[model samples]
Target: MKLEIAQSTPTAASIAMLVQEHYGLSEVVESEFLRRSFNQVYRLGLTDGRSLVARLSAERPRGAPNLQFEAAALEHWAEAGCRVSRCVPTAGGEIAIEVPLPEGPRALMLFEHLPGEFTGDTALDIEAFARGLAVLHTAGESYAGPESAYRLDLDYLLQRPLQGLLRAPTMTAELRPQFEELGERLQAAILALGELSQVLCHGDAHGSNNFIQIDAQARREAVFFDFDEAGPGCLAYELAVYPWNLHPRTVDGVLSDKAAQQWRHFISAYREARPVPDADLAAIPRFMAARQFWLLGEYAGRIPVWGSQAMPTDYLRRQVTMLRKWETLELPL
Candidate 1:
């Protein structure tokens, strides 16, 4: 009987071979495993002292079309002069190469490695990062590419995750009802807001995905990468991600002084590049709740491949506690 495999990690040697064969980069000296989460990433070193990143997407429900959407968006953004990690086309001019593995076919795409450091605690760094995100939003507004398989809508952000939590064996009976109630309340609140400004959101805009560097004028600028979660979504939802990361895991969801300061600087800087309507600004907190739910679902959905250790019972309980705390906060953006 043939054994079933849920996932497989392709060897670094195989990745080097693929890069050389498909990308025409004969100078690749090393291919090292960078990290693994939803997707596997590798860092490739070239003989010319340049570097590249190769991302092998895990088996996504949307398959190759989804990868294509990502590629197209990156290309579009790059053309618009946004500091994005540009995708390198294969020898055949394909944006992504489909490679069959033991588990399934994963899309492999290479990108030019960007230079800069992650945003720091300083106001300048935070502001630059915020401005970069605003630029991305502005650039994405003109995207006329194929529709993304995923949408950062209520179903993807709220319902699906809530359902995943409900199905998790670790979720206690007491916690299940709480999640459902919160989910319902969040959905209702969002729906009550009616229509909102939509843009191609860098779904994971939580500061860390961006790099900050000072330009010739000594002004900090940001270059963004890791757009794995990007898609068309509400502007408020896109802005909410930064604050959600800043939110401390406390019972009373009040923003810490540092968090509040960072948020103020970020929003102020963001507004300089693009206008954020009062309605969208006000809706940010609610969208933050939705982000939490989306994350819960993402982790739960990955349990089969990642295992229970990633989302232990304690972590779930802490997340629920945070959700409850978030409900209590009166954040006025």
Candidate 2:
């Protein structure tokens, strides 16, 4: 499958017909702000003064069939007053729509837009965000979706060590050595660790994927978005991402000193929400290292395209440097 990352911008007029057909809305308009990420998000306007979100898949088979699980989870969360975007169900209770594309039929799902500001690098409420994540982790705890058995399994890490390894046509010869070295090191480290602790994680629970609701008085609360990656997984695996996701310093490129500082605030807030088990706590450094290796390996895969850009070059160089630095950190765990 040739996966071209979706960057095509859809207009309101093009989506109006689809929204009206699926949602039975009398009127629909294109959203003003488009979120550019893995998938393109559009703000949907309706005649009844209500708004919804239209998530369009950039590839064919329009939407992944498994995404229905996300709709179910969102429905569950919204009913519990979690401020999640509500999946717009069809009259027969379906939340996903299959749209035809050049490669194949793509999947599109609609959700009621929750009012709030997106919490990115600056002004994110870590404490509140952690609490909300705890709430989500505990939601439908007993309900194991299709990925239940593989929740804590190492298959993804085992089989898919790194992807997009040679996308860049201009990768330097010296960089090849570093990429292969990192990939091998990551695979070995993850394999050495036995079965990991299992938990329902928000999968990609990072700052950008979350929204913060501020009251008239300026008080704030956090709400999670983007359940595309949500599923059962190792608790530590999920927590391990905080250092890179919410910390602006790390985004510029990998930086051990910044990651070290961010982990404290992130973990403290997360602990306040839901205590980390002693076993996972002991494995934080290993998990952190694993996370770094995984990140570097991923970038290596995309080096062909990403390597052409200056930002990715700096980022990759920094990551290579940071991984070496972390080796000497002597984490308490």
Q: Which candidate is the best by lDDT?
A: 1
Tens digit of per-residue lDDT, candidate 1, span 98-190: 888988777898998999999998999999999999889888989999789898888888997788878877888888887899899888888
lDDT of 2 at 65: 39
| Candidate 1 wrong stretches, greater than 4 Å | 60-65, 250-254
Instruction: Please report, in order, the local distance difference test score of every candidate based on alpha carbons.
Output: 0.85, 0.60
Candidate 2 lDDT tens digits, 145-263: 34422343344542343333323343456665776576566556655655566767676776667788888987778877776666677787777666545333342344456455555
Error of 1 at 49 (Å): 2.7
Which residue pairs does candidate 1 place in steric collision? Answer: none
**Cα deviation of 322 in candidate 1 (Å)?**
2.0
Candidates in order, TM-scores: namely: 0.94, 0.77
Error of 2 at 184 (Å): 3.0
Superposed Cα deviation of residue 117, candidate 2 (Å): 2.3
